[model samples]
Target: MNHLSRRAFLQGSALAVSAGAVSRIAAASLPEAVTQTQAGTQPPLTPASGRPYQPVVTLNGWTLPWRMNKGVKEFHLVAEPVLREIAPGMKANLWGYNGQSPGPTIEVVEGDRVRIFVTNKLPEHTSVHWHGQRLPNGMDGVTGLTQPGIKPGKTFVYEFTARRAGTFMYHPHADEMVQMAMGMMGFWITHPKDPSFMRVDRDFVFLLNAYDIEPGAATPRVNEMTDFNLWTWNSRAFPGIDPLVVRQHDRVRIRIGNLTMTNHPIHLHGHEFVVTGTDGGWTPPAGRWPEVSADIAVGQMRAIEFDASEPGDWALHCHKSHHTMNAMGHEVPTMIGVDQSSELKKISQLIPDYMVMGDKGGSMGEMEMPLPDNTLPMMGGQGPYGSLEMGGMFSVVKVRAGLARNDYRDPGWYRAPAGSVAYEWQGAAAYLPSAGGSRPAAPAASPSSKETVVNVVKPAAHKH
Candidate 1:
């Protein structure tokens, strides 16, 4: 059966009995269970400092001709952008692959001879870095390290066998930070012989992304965290987009990857995912393993499978809170109408309170608007600003278990696309005092004039 249909069935079963309890657990962080393996002597993989694994894939973009009669099962990728989120209600020109951020997820089986032809569409030089697959040096997509970066308007072919069955990722190793932040990462999964053990009722993948935007501008900017503007799942934010969907009671597999310079500790609500595979290969013998959550590093991939025994709109997101906002919040002291610099510090001692707001009882009311409760940020190595001080990046994954498409209910106003970061923008809109006064009459002019007279515009929180 198709994964989606099976997912619906399981979700429905889960919802009938434990909806309330599951809902309660959706947002709470459960403690991880630490145990020794059968040998009882080897150390377990600690969450703090697990050894880093690498995966790699080839990338080239080219049009397939009818003359190319044979079907190409193995594939490579190039991360580029055709559309981008610049600001609330604005899309911009940015770099990404396959017309979106977080290039497409690639799934394969072990021992398959994967052949990938990469065609370069960008005007500049770039290459694809497989995060954790151990291939021969020639198959590595390093620009200068393994091979020269693919030039614009060219194609490179990579051939390799799937020796590993696990979760891995791909991205550009050249200009590591900037290119990745611009949306060049995606999830990769491989299944080995006897794939039945890896089978599941549902499968989902996500590529997490963060954007830095300038206030009042339509497009997000480059990698200066101070000006970072928005966070997203896959590509878009919430409320302005759609949510990831799943059916009840389905055995689901979610392949997650982080492509940016920073690491992401992804958490799923209401359930824990089994870390069945890593970047290099499958666990000694792939089967269910106990792990409530997993930390996915930059350019790294992790394949996690879980049973959807509980049904509800579950949240999946990163743990860093600051990574969820648009660029405006990143500026130090983050405010206007106040001069906190040395030039104005003497004349504006009182203004610092309004500008920073950090001095007042540990709060910045607007920036602290509550994220959807069930969702949390993945605070693995650093917070949003690369240190514990700023918090970390985060997002939400909504799991609608057991409900068939026809049986599903609208999950309120905002929903995000599968595998992307999401944000809340309610505080960004202007507000008028609720003075218990009568509604003001429309001005004797165009609607624009009435809006100008009242200074009230509709509120819309942009989500990807």
Candidate 2:
């Protein structure tokens, strides 16, 4: 027989053996009409509904279709290979669910019975583990323990009731070391039954993933555990990640899941937020406290809520410097105090392109060193103040006062109010002390003095 026929025959034989007598008895007991209805009728699946909650648009977005079967929501997730872009110039071959790395977000309502069907299209066995969810032991998706793994070309089903509403995730429990490193993961969000409980105007969700793909390479080195180079918010690095836009004064909730080897201290500028919930569910009012940053460890999730009261473009990124860089050399020696100038003078005579780096300090990020094809600089980008010198795991949150509640478009940069922007000092007022302390004698008012005085000063610019 041909390859296709032989494979089909083998699969059928395996299923018959696997099913044994229980399958025959169950099939025989079902009435013909009931069986026909079950086979022909399919319910339509609707997106999780919570009025006034704005859906977050995933960068390079994709999502699975769901259907209601006998009041239970059914979702099909296929595990297969995919090509994913990390940034503008870099793309990698990865294994994920439904054609995207860090597979699509699965959103459902709490207390709903859901059935998820996972088909293994991978080359080897695989299983899905619902991380941080309370489910039956048999449906835990642990290969060879809770249940046998789904072999290649086979399918497995996991049915459970989403008892608690929180931010969670899913990944392969079988061969996780290799599977997860290859980018096989996705986000899971269970909204509360009561829409008003812990409600927000905008709900954003994303997974933090890391990879160690070498420069110019198209696939991640699955063997590397800790020394990952590319840090991503959703398998996409900075400059490629879409900004989180919200209307001024709107309540916002951002749910972040971390699957990388190291922890990420996610920081948001210009605002302090409360840790409203976690993988375990909403934090008690007493446990909630204001914070500017939240640390999410590997295999953990954090949900933070804040009011978009300020109108500006604020930064949201990991506080770890290296985590903000892409493809950085971890072993590069620190030359901050070392002077390679004298030696470089002779080297430059033979090679005109040779140049010294990190001599005085703060020059590493400023150097225009050549990088490999399909690779990003360790630190790069342009900002209002000049070179942003940032990469990986970084994005902006744009808030505007007149933005429509439903509009999620970027509003460009913020415009400063008159006399509010920092600029080079033109010899403004020099010093000031508390009203209780001694003060300088009042000087005669000049034409400029009539204008409002700004106490800001510009420090001397440093040389690289």
Candidate 3:
């Protein structure tokens, strides 16, 4: 037979044999399996009596469910193509796990043994590296170093005990440059042994990822390393991002994992927090310090905790201004201090829409320039004051008093107290005493009432 015919015959034979074996096994284990399934439907394992910290992490997304095999949890993660929406109008074709980019968060309790089966559905070979995980040397998942790569259409199993409890992540170790750039990553969280040790009322988790896709393009350029334009949190841009909601005085923990090329200094307005844990493990009380912003480096994870004392809609975003924008053009020239008004007037004769911009300073944020379809403007958003002028990797933390402990709904915008808002001065002007010790009269209104009048006299013209 030819090569194609022989390959097809072999695949068919294998499938037939696998199906027969499954049928036999199912018939033999039917009774035992039913019992086990019934038992598995019971409540999940919980901490011993008096433990304060229960696992309350709101994946902020979703979690991967597992099968209970004996005493071990079995999870299946399939790496395949996915069409994910970064925001309302922007979507990209990416490679991720189990049909979603930054695949479902895997939450397990400490001391539990887990088995993860990763199926490679991509055209190329792939392997998953458990970032910051401690496992047998042979199960490290590094291609050629610890284990062989999982060839396309093949699956590999990784078994390990959850030794530490902290924030962690996973991504491909083989062709990492291409796979990670294509958005193959996921969050792995292990709950502490003593649940109440670091208990918090609310917990949020997300991954920081970047992509280099040209405006209007659907796929990311996997080769570009430093010039990424699409910055995202959980592969989502701002406005599309769900705000973090909490009740006043609630203890909150936010875990951030960075899988991008560069580091990000995540900043939070109107609050202070401390780095409580990392991928390595939890930080001791003595080792912790307060911070308004924390720098998370590539392949690193940081967990920050704070008390939601101040109630309002607070901005939480990357401190890097460019990181908070989408499809930003880094190569654009600076037009500040350049006189383009006269040229623009002439150009408008030919193109009626032509207008001069940035002559005094950069005004891209204020201008409603046209952008490609399915692309977000470099800076955009409306705020109570005016334009928020921000995009990617930005979100708000809505804290309100009297919200139920378990309520995670956004409470809408906060209303500021009266007389606190800044406004333009328009009512009247005050007068001061002159050098003769008498108050100067206020400026009189113009006779026409259509224009205002100035009381000061003009200086004499100089003859140079």
lDDT of 3 at 290: 94
lDDT of 3 by residue, 237-306 (tens): 7656777888999999999999999999999998999999988898999999999999999888999999
What is the C-alpha lDDT profile of model 2 across 254-327, one tens digit per residue?
88989999999999999999999888888999988999999999888998999999887799999998888888
Candidate 2 matches the true fold with a TM-score of 0.79
Candidate 3 regions exceeding 4 Å error are 1-60, 345-355, 425-464
Better by TM-score, candidate 3 or 1: 3
What ranges in model 1 sit over 4 Å off?
1-81, 86-88, 218-220, 223-227, 240-242, 284-292, 331-464
Q: After superposition, how far is residue 448 of candidate 1 from its true place, in Å?
A: 31
Q: How many Å off is the CA of 9 in candidate 2?
A: 34
Superpose all Cα atoms of candidate 3 onto the true structure and report the RMSD in Å to 1 decimal.
Answer: 13.7
